[model samples]
Target: MFRISPFIFILIFLTACTLPFNQPILTEGATVPRPQNAATAPVEEQTEPPTAIPDTQTQPTDIQNDTTNGATTDNLEELANTTPADRDQVALVEALTGNDLPEFARTEPLDVQVGDTETFWVSDILNDSNYEVDARLRYAGPHVLMYFETAVDDQIRQEDIDRAAQEFEERIYPRNRALFGEELSPGVDGDTRLTILNITLQGAGGYFSSADSVVQEVNRFSNEREMFVVGLNSFPVGESSYGSVLAHEFQHMIHWHEQRRGPAWFNEGLSTLAEDLNDFGDDNTTILHIQNPDIQLTTWSNNAAQTGQHYGTSQLFMRYVYEQYAQDGGLAQLIQDDAGNNLAAFATMAQQTRPDINSFADIVADWAVANLVNNPSIDDGRYAYSLLPETTTPVDLELNTINDINQFGADYLTLPTGTTTLTFDGSDTVSLTGATPNSGQYAWWSNRGDDSVSTLTRSFDLRDLTQATLQFSLWHEIEYNWDYGYVAVSTDSGETWTTLEGQTTTKEDPQGNNAGTYGLTGISGKPGIETDQGEVGQWIEEQMDLTPFVGQEIQVRFWLIQDDAYNANGMLIDDVRIPELDYVDDFEEADESWEGQGFVRTTGTLPQQWTLRLVKEVGSETIVESVETNEAGQANISVNDGETGVLVVVASTPYTTQTATYTIQSETR
Candidate 1:
């Protein structure tokens, strides 16, 4: 159900490209803010080799002066004496490249140091070997650093980086801390620094890499490090767009440090959620998945065709959890719990928040249904939150009564008048002579003490026809005195109605005989009314003439009414036909009175001959009927009476084959 619209995707993609500062931002060296009672433990240092060191041409000895040694008491006093801006700039540089560098950066001596006039440089840190200075920035705030590539400094101005840093420090960092209950700071190993480098990361708009992975090639990059690096796509994405990616990757960094990264779905979902929390707006791709419930959420592969759906569904599922189950810091608790598995972590969180939920599968099933109906009040608000856009609506009935009754096994339709509850008895519990004609696979039984009006109407212009005949097969056992079914018509939709005369009702006697009685017999006087004198095992075919209303735009309706108690086997109507117009029948619900008849319409500029074949399954019998459509594109075909069997109408053309099936009951009367 994930409906993917390329236009919407492109629109969102362009919006992300235009709004750079909307990305989530993290301040360097932010720490998880813990409760007063909860002591903040220091992150244990890991003595592992660097994951991948930058391929730099020069040695990292150019700026190797110890930061603590350089800032003497007199020098500190001088620094304090300077302007506020200069003091803040010096403080930030010290925080980023001081004696305690990120754990990964500490593996090798880093040529990172503050220069005169408050400027700092990390030599060849961006892995851009072509440039001697990989990243250079001027400190803009106590926790913010502004970087602009020297190669594109003319195009990428200092103001852009400063704006990005301001947004990150002001908007993104505090928001994340509020939701995550932690500050974005270095991990326990202290091998890396929280730094945002504006450079082209290979193959992605932005990416987060642990310091350990960046420093040297390690067997695996463990997230249990003090600091990580954020690489933003450095193509002048503006501050908002830049902040969006930062928010996304920052969640990754946080998840790495606070909780062991689970699956790609969880990591991506949380990161995307981070973007939303920072007010970057919901990821449009995720909206697609939220609208479509049929998409599988768990299995995700990078190269799979459904990669976008995977990302979207993951984000939506997490959003649902965050909104429905974990509004009160449960998300943060789950992440910190680090249950070691995604399902286990989710289950634990659900148990603490939604104790009623038994398992993750329950949540999924409820969530899937919610994605369709979205009514929170349903089922005690279990699947209540509406994360998807307002564009989503409830699912329509798969098969409407007018289209295919066999699929529904009953005459079910949304009536214009009001609601009607018609229950079908498909178990063959009530029968005649051991044959369940009235109780075939499908038969609607009226409810006792129920007085309601159920009508099925079809509208069409009959101006072109000289004569119109209404014919149908019926099996009924309504309360003789109070309940009845009638055939009616209207020219003004359902505003007014006129009943057709000569209608009759039939019911099977206790001895399996068709007992016919006049009820509201239509014009033709119930021509084929079976009179076996028992429970009408043999179905009766009736006809009504609509010749008077032939030249007008008219609507025909079948009304079945029941009142008071003592309801019997109600009715089974099938193979209803208005020749030259349409035919509707449910093979599973038909009785012996059903006739193999239907209409086939073909459209072409020229008249075309077509074949209509009626195949009976009992004897493997095939009856082929041929007809030609007029210039107006209409063909009506009627097959004569056939032996009891499954009857199928195959309308064939050179290019198409359309088939409809019905069941003809054995005539026992």
Candidate 2:
């Protein structure tokens, strides 16, 4: 929970909103202070890595998932830092970074030696900024300069300072750079010596200010000099936690030079892991995440529960990634990924390190399962926690407690103890993560409910077609190698099932927690055409071949399956229609009612014109069309196996007012 953000408090409290520090372990190092008041949401999101606003995004917050601008840009920094419950200084810096005003015109900070007195601007977090710290450079290491506030007479013990200084210079400094690379060498300060100012901060253990990373031009509170801030009173001087806190903050300094605008979850995750690599540790916080595994993986909020969960989730994930992927130095490649991203960067790293996976959700899925059983012997260790010991509390789930999981969040659901395979009674998982729809005014989104399935089903008569293909537009990010969104055909009147393969389908062992048992719908330990990995951030056209079943009466059903843990933004099904696949059904809850009367026929002449689907406000001039549906209230769309055609739709004057009125009007020309 060390990574707190100012905006998270604003979003969590509807208006607005750290920990105490610890001593150092000169041997292995101590853990960081329990970062209190971190901004996080039980609502779950990494965009909520996964920012698709719904159609009616009129409000600033859409309850659990969507976090929009509740206030104006002018009030952003103010609101973000105004929450009484959260005086997180780190968040204040995040707010300033978003304004994009300050330019990094290095002020050429004075290079001082050990025993030189200097003053730097420090944020008075409790009082909304403003403070001056007169600190004397106490230790000059080969790689860093440590300073202590001089105002407190005899406050810091000399030996404690010496121990802390020695650790930073001799231990923490070298290990951090060797593992995670350097912290802006000769950075904005134009020197390899990163200024570490130990001042009395308000409520933060410590922070690396992006504002200070740049020279203060438009902003005055900036030290104008490059320095990282750590609280003096928060931690005992000689404490080993210094290694962790300093290492954590140092990573932030390194990241600042990359993407100034980045996801707090990812940034904090890497830094939290930095603590571990520095010999300091996470204080066994993974249990917190294991207990409440449903928090959104990529979002930050200001609160006690979410803050703790975010840190625990992120650190555990990073630990998993580093341990599993670092063996071949792929972890460094992951570090070099686009810093401004969330799951996408992890996805890119996965493609390179583990060829079997292709989505960040894939790693998350494995991590989720591994959290339950931290055994390296299981499934070739693809789903166990090697970062932390296997000694953890057992998972206890209250029935029917799992529901409506958000983007990049995860939930663990258990079937009856003796259950071998998972079959939804009628429930589901799928969610929308982007704003622009694939093709209509709206698309169907399935919330990624754990151990659930979102389905779209209807009877299809493919007896007459020589060649048939079920085509649709979809955007999906499912936990790869573990979860899937697939299409299954039932020819026996809703009795048997066969997974249909499409352009986006792939096969993998989805048995993380469900190992040695059946998990996905059709395939047990084998491969099937499923929405496994890969993050299609936007909607893309895809097709399911139905030509093989051309001479049969089968019920075609679109499905999305989630295992016992890990979630991402659900699938967005836009234009395919078993009578409009947009009418998605949470298969675990109810059967979908896709009401429409249509037949697929192959006639080269009549079917030459492509079908146009129009979603327009009644009597309004704006008509969102799949084809050219502009003039008359008619759409001529007929498709065969030949050349593609366009559908033209024309609206009438019956739709004149725009007061939240919508109509799906399509006619044959």
Candidate 3:
């Protein structure tokens, strides 16, 4: 397992495709077998994070962006430099300005047609305010208002506008509207026609601003127009992917109106799907993802290196979900569901469409299987890609110590060639050692994703114990007062629950004033965890007394809860044991150290081999004999004539999922 850079800053802002989405306010939870104590040392942000595996095979060049397709490529170089901070600040300010709605710049609609010219406030590539433009409406359909930046209108060909308008009115608008639901129509911009301001966007092909849908009498902040800011340079009319960009940006508009709470990954996924649905084109980012599948699916950042993977993988997952489970309008259901984000949104969509699918994990499990083994011919394409061509080249390596492979990501490893037998033992040879506490990362679950819940649980019969003390090595980098990580117990089969406090449990006052503790169980930590510097504090040996329920059978769970706003690696637990019950779990052995989502140390070869080869395991044929492993994580892998043994280690959670594997790989002799 290769160690990607430890620094992954999540952008938790509102922006369209190509712009960094909501960044991690503070996170990931890994099932560390045992993390020795380390302190959170102050550090500066890295220039960029990770070991980006390069593509060995030649990637098919994108034909959509060539000069031949009418796309202006000179300014495409300017795309990556445009930061989302301006849009993020605008959103933050708007949120803070809650209920302070101002009068609309215009109470009525723009009574204009295709040739009408209008002066509109537009942001430059940098989202600077003073870049207003007078734009002529080129395409005024019943549903769309395609405006050309008058400055560049003469340069753009009339044929390109006709081609783009035809797609928008006939293909993009109706198709997306039917699939993703409607954008805010007759909006505060006083227009029924959704505006598509085709300016030369800073670096993005286009972006949707909530500010455009907003209004104020004097404040120049809001565009006070229902519009999407598109770049003339990125998607010159008549370009192949232009309709896709339109479809993509249109989705952000509708999504803003509908499921505003949806996570960036989910929203971006749907937006890309909008492109696919409109018949514009498939997502071009797949090559980036196949080259580096270890990019965390749910976690997002502004880095140019990983941004393509983020979009590519997002489309890959969402498209899989849509293809496999979304039978009766599931995509629409997902966009309409306001309560769900990430896997939660899919869970809701699945429940409504396909009731048999209990959790998103089931889908993820199938999808993971599909990623490694994509055979559309098998099981009705359940374990295959109906849309994407599988282009994974699993990183081949000897068994090395893999520490923090980000969640909802997978690391495919090819065993060294010329090996006859392979063995894996989960004890010392194989274990998920969570990120080094207080050091490179916060805890075992290092850099947890926003709105994620990672849990480690076990059921225990405590009737024999007179007194029991729960003990564990715990470290957390939770957002103070806003997000939480704690130990909770449930006696009624998880129907009801009670939180057990520990040494670090403190009432966090989100406000500066010492407000009532209320239901908020502040930051769970020792005195020094909250340092002036943002690095996580040291790991603490914690205990929560369970003596009160000594006579009953109980279920105990270690939990981490994060909100959508900020970033914080929720919590990490290691060496958990109860004194009276004489039960202990070091997470070293391939057994039930604890039974839950965060970490599973497996026995034999089920977990390891599942992620390894044997792409499809259905009906009578075992792709290859299962490699046998002992109490120690040792696997006996049989290498064929020229084929390499590819081992994949993956874990999925409710909202946030990630890939983590052992440092221990089969040493080919």
Candidate 4:
């Protein structure tokens, strides 16, 4: 294992731990770097556009002609003599104009001719704290990530970082579709490029990703850009409810569509509205249930309430006013009504929405009162109280050699006896990429002798077997001659065998029916078994029900008797196993006594509650003891279940808690 920083290693280890069982199981593009790591949910909504083009008045352009024959030489001389300090100022101007800057001191030189690219006076290097960068959109070529750094430390909060991302997605590039309604290209230079790094909360100000995992943040004046920042300090770590913080910032980008900029109320209120309210007639409002401080809904923040509530309630207040007063155009209309103005007129317009502006204040007061008994539970669809019984350690059975059975691989299994090694390879087709070789052999074979028996005994347990499965492998070349294989079971070691299964395959004529004579079959052929090249690397998976064979200790054996030498060439085996229930049966195995009966059973409600039916065969019966389950979804108990005449349990509410009893049932016939 490579050494990683504490943060990186922790994340990596968690990733591996949580991969085996993922909540809301992910599909496609999901990577599990380690266990115990929660999988990230896919972005359900775009939330915001990629980037917002600055809305500014256009300026007329003027150009001077280079009339002199020596003008080109003059320009080169002037450019070469420019000082580094002069170039910095020029670069700053270029940034504002969204134009490329020329090569200057403190920067690498550009080889292209001056005519191909524009120039700007470079300014001070932008640092991390003072500014932020929206590096999510720019993923291609050199200098794709814009830098925004300040001298101030601890300026970049996690929430601010997340908000910046959401705003860019919802405001700028709405989706992968081009402005002209064309599909975006796959690469970064293309329109629909995606940023590898999602969000960072490190010491750096600007964000840049050289690859999917690495990021670099720097604080320099020259790095300053119009980057968005979010503040995550308002919420607790691991608490997902504060997702509205993202929605709030996203509205900033959306509001920019109507008004280029505005006061904190208009921007903040509208952004807040994205959390609890929406006027677009779309259900884009964030869906979150807040607990505590439940007052009549009003625009007020509670210290005790979670972070999401503060921002969400703020947005809800703004939305309530907009919906009540403005019907025709609403907020959108109000923004368009302003000729590049601020929220000063908002108070007046808000009067139309709420005649009693003070009503919201009362609502907030009511919320404070309601906070006393406001403890509500929440379900976010991704978690549950008790999922499944946790397995502390893996099953103790020796996977390398089950019951002395040895030699198994993805494609082939071999059992060595005498001079020849019997091989059964499952030419199973591959479903997952890079999992196992699809063309190789897969099999499990054992030739271990039981110390107490003379004949070779092969105990087999197969769970899923089905009809139409004639034990065929795709790698076997010969046509269907599969009738030669036979399956048998023996009770007393392998002394006597009872034929249980057999399969046969035939080569039918292309037209369907068998040829007129025996060997004259041009299309139809008799069922025969073959082990040619074709059937060596294929596997057949089937579902079999083995309810009839219980109690009787059985040993299974498969013999591929060859009718023709060609039938002895290839064979593949797969999904080959006799499955046993969670509880092992008592038969020849010693110490099959009642091991202090495990008093755990399943129970449900009246109509669906499980009834425990105990049947006595011989000997005596004893009711040992009973225990109650303390865990959630555990059960309580009742002594009887009507006609079943055994132990019964009344199902509990919330479908929780169960109880079980240990009882020994026997009879003297």
Best by TM-score: 3
Q: Report the C-alpha lDDT of model 3 over 1-669, residue by residue, as the tens digit.
A: 000111211221123234422221111000000001011121232222112211222221221111111211112112112111111212222222222334355667877887889887653322212356788988777777778888888788877887787878888777777887888778776678787788765434566655456553222334667777666665567777567677777877777666544555676777777777777555556656777777777655433345557777778888788777674267777766542343555666656655655555556655765777676665445667656666577665555565445555666656666644555433222112222322221123422443344566678898887878787766554544334566767777765456664555544322211111111122233332321133333455667778777889998876554433233434555567676677766554435435555322221111221223333232443243223344334555556545545565443322232233456545445
| TM-scores, one per candidate | 0.40, 0.50, 0.56, 0.22
Q: What are the per-residue Cα lDDT tens digits for candidate 1 across 1-669?
A: 011123323433445333222111111111110000000122322223122211221211111111122111112122112211111111221221232223243443223443212122221211211122344554335544454444444566556666777787888876776666553353333423455555433223444443223222110122233322333433244745557667776666566546533334455667777877787766566555645434445433222233455566767777778887777477677667642233445666777766855545445544544454456654456545644664333232222222211110111111111222221111111111111222123322221112223345567678888877777665444433234455667776555555554334332111101101213211112223221122232355656667778889887765544321112234445556677566554444324432111111101011111122222222443222223334222333232333321111111111111111222122122
User: What TM-score quantifies how close candidate 1 is to the native fold?
Assistant: 0.40
Tens digits of per-residue lDDT for model 4, 327-380: 334666555543112222444565564443332222222222112112122111
Q: What is the lDDT of residue 501 in candidate 2?
A: 50
Judge candidate 4 at residue 187 and give its lDDT. Answer: 21
Candidate 3: which stretches are off by over 4 Å?
Answer: 1-100, 103-106, 113-115, 125-130, 157-159, 217-219, 338-358, 415-645, 653-661, 665-669
Off by over 4 Å in 1: 1-133, 144-146, 181-193, 211-237, 339-342, 391-669
Q: In terms of lDDT, which candidate is strongest?
A: 3
For each candidate, the alpha-carbon lDDT, in order, equals 0.39, 0.46, 0.51, 0.24
RMSD of each: 36.7, 25.1, 16.9, 34.5
lDDT of 2 at 187: 51
Sort the predicted structures by lDDT, highest score first: 3, 2, 1, 4
The TM-score, computed over Cα atoms with residue i paired to residue i, of candidate 4 is 0.22
